[model samples]
Target: MLTWAGLLTVLAVLTGCTGSTPLFGDNRSPGDAIRIFPEDGAENVGADSRIEVTVPDGRLERVKVTRMEDAEHGQVPGRIAEDGRSWAPDKGARRLGLAGKYSVEVVAVDGGGRRSARNTSFTTLVPADRFIGYFKPENRSTVGTGMIVSFDFNRPVRNRAAVEKAIRITTDPAVEVAGHWFGDERLDFRPARYWEPGTEVTVDVGLRDVEGAPGVYGSQRKKFTFRVGRSQTSLVDARAHTMQVRRDGELVSTVPITAGAAKTTTYNGKMVVSELHEVTRMDGRTVGFGGEYDIKDVPHAVRLTKSGTFLHGNYWESPDTFGSDNTSHGCIGLRDVKGGSSDTPAGWFFERTLVGDVVEVVNSADKTVAPDNGLGGWNLGWSRWKAGSALR
Candidate 1:
């Protein structure tokens, strides 16, 4: 005696009354609904990964991620998106260690004050032993200075061949790049010498999910391009009392320079332009070379070492003494026309040179500067530099 429309209306009212009931008839409590974007059982999350979640007909109240143990309780530092509908952690947190299963959960509340949750689990891919090393400068776009491509491994590498094979470097003009390990976790890539001026350089990193060591894996494939600028070199021989400035291997100037005294001979071996200064104070005690009468204001100084070495304007030294004497403490003294003008040999070199220009210091008695000191790691021999790696 019931009409079809009337019966359907009654059924709809009954369904609304049973709000927040389980979508699947497991007969369990109408608990939180768990919806995983990229789905509940997704595989192959890329290196640059961001996870997304949604709650059907509900607003998310809170979300948390936890290890399978569930004891840690979703507290690994994730970021909620501005829209308040999504969350992700920085690359450092997202890099998963070991091939294993992981879990994510979200909680939301519906219009009827009914709560729901959705849970998802995914298995991460087993990382390969071999991975490609990405090469590129960190931030700066045009490679004007000492910009070398380097990588910071999420895990310490145990097999050098595995990582080395993954790293490949090439240039438009066929410039070569060599890899040198600064330590267990850092690797730098550069040519045997400064890059050819105006050469186009590209570095490719295909090392996603590659096992770096026990319980660690890489999470990225990186690619970047940089343009090499002018080729320039500055040779400073402490004993010669001269700095030969060259552009693209051609001599440009032979400026007389005063070297460090006998007790403080300039450091021998290759160095790079780490920084430049218009006018800076040179404190004697700061470098541990101060005597009772040492002056604090050694002006117009350009620092070359953390140990207080400089190429500065010398007010104390006469012009005749520049090319003839190695007096005072450890510093490269050049004749300047006061006010730190760029026309002086010291200023000209400083203006033309960038932070990564090669400065060859020869004919000194001191040991070679450590490659790890500053960005001078490029000075290490290829075989010797490779030996420092845990993977090698």
Candidate 2:
């Protein structure tokens, strides 16, 4: 339909307008534009290392960092810089797993609206030995004012400073608290004074990847909370052979009691009720005393020390022994029936007591209770307690 010259002109115009563009406009490949940290095939990467991505000439549209073992894939919340070229994971998001293999996928779009994708994988470092800390005052428990947050480590932490720094404690009304180390395997935290009634405390152990020692790494990351209940403290005067119970600082009752005998005296210090049992067996042979007594049904017993000290009912002792004579190996004795009826002194006291209630024993002939003997941390002077802190 057109002349040959005119057809040639049309072809020349078409070639000039679209010759450089292949089929679709600007079909040239974006060609590996995105850069990812912990580069592809990276080994021995830190667990706490932040995953990041940057585009040389584009803006990040989507980014995902997934643990390979769990296949837990989700968009990693990230913040793009003002220039829209650099991106990093959000601060408040959950951290990556420890000793894990991860896959990072990124999608980016340049100013021309061309999309480019990058996929990479890396592995976090594996510790030679993993350590963990078991914390107490169980999560969501309601405890007495004397409750202390204690941690028993599975492995001895040589880098005390690093381990201590990873432990965090916060309170509702806000109190100054400190951690005291008991040797290398135990750490306990408490305020200078007893916890305020009705206060809520939260503990965070962020020990993952913490170098607790050479070639030893901590791998525990957990959070727990506890509430402080009403204040109740019982004062036991060994000289007077009685216990004065107080609630909210008011004398509620004075109960007749008998403490440890003259030879094997009860520990003299502030102690916490660590546990309670309605009926349990007590054997002198088990506590280094060979066959002095073995009661199979000791009733209404409250544990006070790790070394087998208790405030329990002694149905075997005569009624006159209590409030009149100091007798027993190294425990406080209360009058009770053999079967632990609720009406007995031991049962009544046990019903009213909580695990964290404080019991102070005075005028006893024995040396003061060791701070680590039970929940007897309060016996240590404030200066001495703080002196045990690695941070100090």
Residues 175-239 of candidate 2: C-alpha lDDT, one tens digit per residue: 99999999999999989998999999988889989999888888877787889999999999998
Query: What overall lDDT goes with each candidate model?
Result: 0.55, 0.73
Each candidate: RMSD to true structure?
Answer: 25.2, 30.0
The list of candidate 2 runs beyond 4 A from truth reads 1-128
Q: What would you estimate as the lDDT of candidate 1?
A: 0.55
TM-score of each predicted structure versus truth = 0.54, 0.67
Off by over 4 Å in 1: 1-168, 204-223, 290-308, 337-339, 377-392
Top lDDT prediction, candidate number: 2
Worst 10 residues of 1 by lDDT: 9-18
